[model samples]
Structure formats: structure tokens, C-alpha cells
Target: MKMRLEVLLVVTAVMCAAGKPLSKAAARNKLLLISFDGFRWDYDQDVDTPNLDQLAVDGVKAKYITPPMLTMTSPSHFTTITGRWVEDHEVVHNMMFNTSTNLKLPHKLTLTKSQWWDNGVLPLWITAQNQGLKTASFYFPGGAANYSGQVVNRVMVEPFNHPNANETEWRQNIDMVMRWFSEEDFHLVTLYYGEPDNVGHTKGPDHPDRKTIIQQIDRTIGYLRKAIDQHNLADSLNVIISSDHGMTTIKKRPLVDEIILNKYLNLLKLASFEILDYGGFGILTPQPGKEQEVFDALSNAPNLTVYKKNEIPESFHLAKSERLPPIVVVGDLGFNLNSRFIVYVNKGDHGFHNGEMDMKTIFRAFGPDFRRNFLSEPFDSIHIYPLMCKLLQIEPAPHNGSLTVTEEMLQLHSGGSQRAPVSVALPLLMLLTFSAL
Candidate 1:
């Protein structure tokens, strides 16, 4: 009787261990989130992109993806990942400044420091990890930093000094990402390449060199596809290709004294401010009791619009945070806040506004989860975060986008199927069996 009871207990323990429900991690779908900085929606139309064109043919293509208000790099990128706008995510500008400490958090630090990135909201990587999935990042902004006291399983910060190294690194990056995918623990991945945006700044969007840069990236896409096929992950992998925001041509530079704040507001009285004579926009922080004074001075400034912090339109998502400057000034189309001594005559510029065609970027989805060869109506980029969460079979953090908005772009398998598929369950069960043994 004692021997029989012992055998039964062992059997019961095995059965219980094997019967464990499909966890979020075991059921998670694999995703590769790729960001090609400043790759505009119409860029392919301008340049021949065979790889990108093939991706469009194979999966859903959004004609143009609207970026968040301000349409800047750090803001829009964080918006896509967090499903929150610039104001909500707290990466208001590429360079975030803390008024209280008089500390400026530049782009480089924003990549590695928790103080710069962890603003109460967890990004998708952290959220995925909570559900048991592992994440890796390759040069994606915000991926290098600690989010809510945790970092991804793997992180590689692309060096800024070696800008030219990107071309060579593209092939290497694809190999590394494929390696992560082969790891059972790595369920989500992100890769970033800053090009055409870089070229656009120097050579303008229409320049031959900018088009060449796009072509170069397209070839990298082809290499990625070939590598994935070789690794037999073509069917299992889901790839999302996107860009932060588009670039627009800039020529006009306002004289330094031409700026209302520079012209009238006492510079010594202000806490901290940004006003470059060459760029189309700037922000200002009044010391105290000077909000109205700064606002009044910038009132009716030609070719520029100024707004008090509270007065900025809610749709822009610019006014709610204390991190925002007290006075925000935006330049009209083709105009920048240039000064008399130094002029900004960059060939291309962004941060104008989301409505501008040049500020509109690309969104193309390719993989098992998306519908094939479909062209979607232009949609907001924020919806992407929800789509990503839905694909990974994980819960998304509280985000502003509605899943219904992006539902049409996905296939049946990608939607509402939180249960682990038989394909995944079998492997998980085997692993559990080994663990029990």
C-alpha cells in the first residue's frame, strides 16, 4: 500500500507539472521591429527599392503613417514603441532638459540612463518581459536605457562617431538579429539604422546621394530576407519596418534679433531656452512671472506661431507636461529660427508638424501575422504599439491608440488568439517534461 501511494504521488506531480497553462512567454509570437530613421512614405516612390517593394507586395502597406505631434525623432520613435505621445512618454525633444536641475539630457544619455527614459511607463520590451518573453535591441533608441529598472536581454548601442560604419554594420546587424531569433529566450527584437535622414540633412531628400542611401538600405533588407530564409525562419518571423518621421526642405533662416525672445525678452532673466537662427522652431522657459511677457513679445511674430504652455492645442500633446517649455514657438513652412551671426540652412528638416507631407514616414508590415499584399488607408503611427502587442500575444501598456484602428491590417492568426498554438505547446510540454525528469 505504501509503494502504490508513492507511485501515484509521482504520477500526480508529473501530470500537474505537464498541465501548466500556456504562459504569455511560451505563447508569444516573435517580432522584429526595424526602424529606418527618416525613411519617408514617398521615399520608395522617388527611389527604386526592390526589397521594400517586395515587402509591400508580400504584406500590408500603409500609404503613409502619421507621426505624433512635433514629429521629431526621439518623440515619434518613443510614441511608436510606448503607444504614447511625446508628452505622455516624456521624451518631448531629442534633447530632454530638466528645468529644476538645470540638467540637459542629450540624445546619447537618453540611450543609456534610466533617469532619462524610465518615466513611470514601461515600454513594450519590459511589458513583454513581465509576461516571460525575452527581448533584444540593436541600436534602437530607448532600447539601450533601463526601463522601469530593467533592460532588455541584449543591447547594442550603435556608435555615433562611426557614422560611415553603418553600411558595413548592416549585414552584421542582420546576422546578430537572426542569432537572437534562434535563441528560445529572445522573442522580441528591435533594429535601427539612421541613414537617409542623415543624408537628407546634408544632401536634401531629393539628392542622388539620399536616394543611394535608400537603395543601400533596401539591399540590406534583401540580405536580411535571404538570411532568414536560410535559417528556416521565413515562416515564423514577423518583421515591421518603420521610420520615425519624414524630412522637409529648409531654406529660410530668421535673424537672431528677429526672434521675439531674443529681440525683447532679457536672456539673463530666462532659466533656459533654445533659439537657433537657422531652425524652423524653438522653445523657451521663462524664469517666473514672465510667461505673459515672453508670450506677448512673440505675439504676431511673422511666419512663426507662439503659444503659452497651457495655450498649446491639446491635439498636439505638447502642453500638459512640466518638462515642456513655458513658451513654444513654431516656424511657418520653409522658415527656421536662424540668427544674424549663425544661419541654419540645412537642406532638409523635420519637427515642423505632423500634417506636413515631408513629416510623414513609412509603415510596412511583413510576416506571418499580417495580411498579404494589402494597402491600408493612411493611419496614425501610435496604433503600431497595439498591433505589436496583439501580435506577440501579450497585453499592451495603457496607450492612446485603439486596437480596432489597426485591426484591418492583420490576419486572423494575429488577432485575439492569446492561447499558445499547438506548434508552440508541443515544444513547451517537452521542455516541461525534461524539467520534471
Candidate 2:
């Protein structure tokens, strides 16, 4: 009887040591991702962004994170969430091709739940959901409509310009996020602010109005921080702020002339060619036997580099799906390509390959789970997803590169540990036990 009791005690101790129960308070902690679109890292104008600056000073600041090739809203947001580049997800731009179906119109593109899963990609919200945590987003680019086909716990879908127009929309969105934060069921929320990007695009980054817009955005950040404090959720919530891409002013002549393109169309015997503004120049699809001819025509074009699908840079990690045009064209600095003949030339635009280091955007994090007074070395935007996953105590979706500099920031907050052992290991063991049963 004594020997049996000793064996039982040893087994119980081994089990307790190997798999401990996680503190509910720690496991239920939250993550908030905020995207301040079109925000540049070097815009050190003395604005009213005390709260955002506080975040920078208190957490990690990722300097010089490069945007994707198109640098468009959809692809940038997707890359930030998915840890995959434009090509891998088949979403290269705000306007994308649904090659799964032979549809050309937006309405014909049915976004079913399986579509998101079939892509082999999962956004941070989805990952949180899989961990049995509630998730929400307000007006994220692709998040406007339910891509997953299932309604997220909280989703705010309204036109960019609605009744609560201007900065008020941003403030209200943050308010909604605060409400969600107070909920015991919720664990993750995402808020997107489009004013800086919108105003920056309409009136170049140097425009006088840009200053006012940044100040308003800064105030909104202050409001959000205040709300977090008022709700007593500061310590339990991790706030991550990032931007989709940076903006730039365009003063140079259009690099690819529409007329020159149309004139050369016959030489390549192509069916259709479209010139995207801000150097997203590409051939949609060429007629049979014209692939090589079109490739040759644009390969050596001045101020541009052309590549066939297979020849694109490996670093880009874009997919080889049919959504990608057979030929990809990228413009050099001080150049843009336009298909729509607008009467007036826009003074400001992003999405062009300007090769300017200043064009890199900003990434900052604040909360109990982040490091302070540190700057992440220049890294790609795709690195953000892995770091976010790690901070949330979840497994990251399989990705090519490791985590971003923000991981170092998170480690500092987590006591220089790779992860919070209690938060990570406990949930993993529970999940495994449930699966086994």
C-alpha cells in the first residue's frame, strides 16, 4: 500500500509539473492592432501626438519597415495581417482578381468562408478566434466586408465618408473598440484610421492641411489611451500601432505614356493593356504568342524594370497564381504610370517604387507586453504577423522569415523571455488534451 501511494504521488507531481493550469487573468489578456494609414516615420512635425509619442517612448519603434511592391491599401493590410506578400495571397491591390471563378466584376466575386481558408492564410483576428478568443475590426481594408463569410463578434462597415465624417469617425471607432475591450469575451480588436492617408494623397505630404490632419489623428490616439486608462484595461491590453504604407509627392513626368503603350500594342499583338497609376504598370493578359514580345518591349524601357512571373525577385515572395499578370512592370524614382487621363496631375501619391528610404512607414507598440525605448532595425512589414502572434501567445501561421524587431520589444516587456511561459504552454497543453480526447 505504501509503495502504490508513492507511485501515485510521483505520477501526480510529474503531471502537475509538466502541464500547469494557466492563470485566467493572463490567458485572457487582449491585443489591439491599429493601422494609421499613410503615416511616415520621419514626419517629426511637432504635432499633438503626445499619446502616440508616449507609445513610441514606452515601447518598440520599428523604423524603416518597407511596404510591398504595389504599396496599395489592400495588399499592405493583407501583408501586415497574413505575413505573406502581395503575390502569395493573390490579393495584389485593393482591386483584385478572383481567379477561382471566371468573374470580372466585383459583385461576381463571392467571398465565402472557405475562400479565406483555402488561401492558406489567416489574419490575426482569425488566429485569435481559433484560440477561442473573440475578435473585432473597424473598417480594415478587406475587413469592410466579411471575407470569412462568418460575422466576427464586432465589425464596423461603413463608407469611408459617412455621417460621422472626418476625424469623428476615427474617434467613434476607437470608442467602439473600447466597448469591446471591456467585454470579458473579447481578446483582440483592430482599428484603422484613413484620414492621414486620404488627406496626404489628396494634398501632398507637404500640403498645409496635412499638419492639421496629423494633429487630429494624434488627438484621437490621446482619446484612445485615455479610454483605456479610464476602463482600467491598460495593463491587460497590448496596443500595437502600424501603418500600411507611406506617402510621397510626385513631381516628375509620367514614366509610361499611354499613347506610347497603345502605339506599341500592335507590335506585341496583345489583347489588352492597362497602365496603373503610381507605377503599378502591367499587362493583364496577352494574346497567344505575344508573351515574349510584350516582355521584350518593357524589359529595357527606361525608368522601369520588367519581369516575367517566374523571374520576379524571390525576396518579394509573391505567388505565381493567375491573379498575377504574366508580365510585371515596376517604375523607377520620379516616375509614375497612369491609364486614366485626368486633366490635372495629382501632386501627391504613394504605391510608386521611388526607392526613397524616407518612404518607409512606422510601427510602434505599447502596453505591458512590449519593450520600451527601443527601435527595431529596418525589416519587412510581413515580419509583423509573427511578432503579433507571439505576443498574443498563439502560434504563428507558417511564414518565411522570423519575427520583426518588435519581438525584441515584446521580450523586454515579457522579462526578456521568448514568451510568457505560463500564457503559452498552458493553453497549448489544454488544446492538445482536448484534441486527444
TM agreement with the true structure for every prediction: 0.84, 0.80
Candidate 2 residue-wise lDDT, 236-347, digit = tens? 8888888877777755545434323433345335645433444334434556678888777665556666678788777655546546767776655435554334333555
lDDT of 2: 0.64
In each prediction, how many residue pairs overlap at the backbone (N, C-alpha, C within less than 3 A)? 10, 4
How far in Å is the alpha carbon of 414 misplaced in model 1?
9.6
**Model 1 weakest lDDT span, ten residues long:** 252-261
C-alpha lDDT values of all predictions: 0.77, 0.64
**Count: clashes, candidate 2:** 4
Instruction: Indicate the residue-level lDDT of 67 in model 1.
Output: 93
At residue 40, candidate 1 shows an lDDT of 84
Please give the RMSD of candidate 2 to the true structure: 7.2
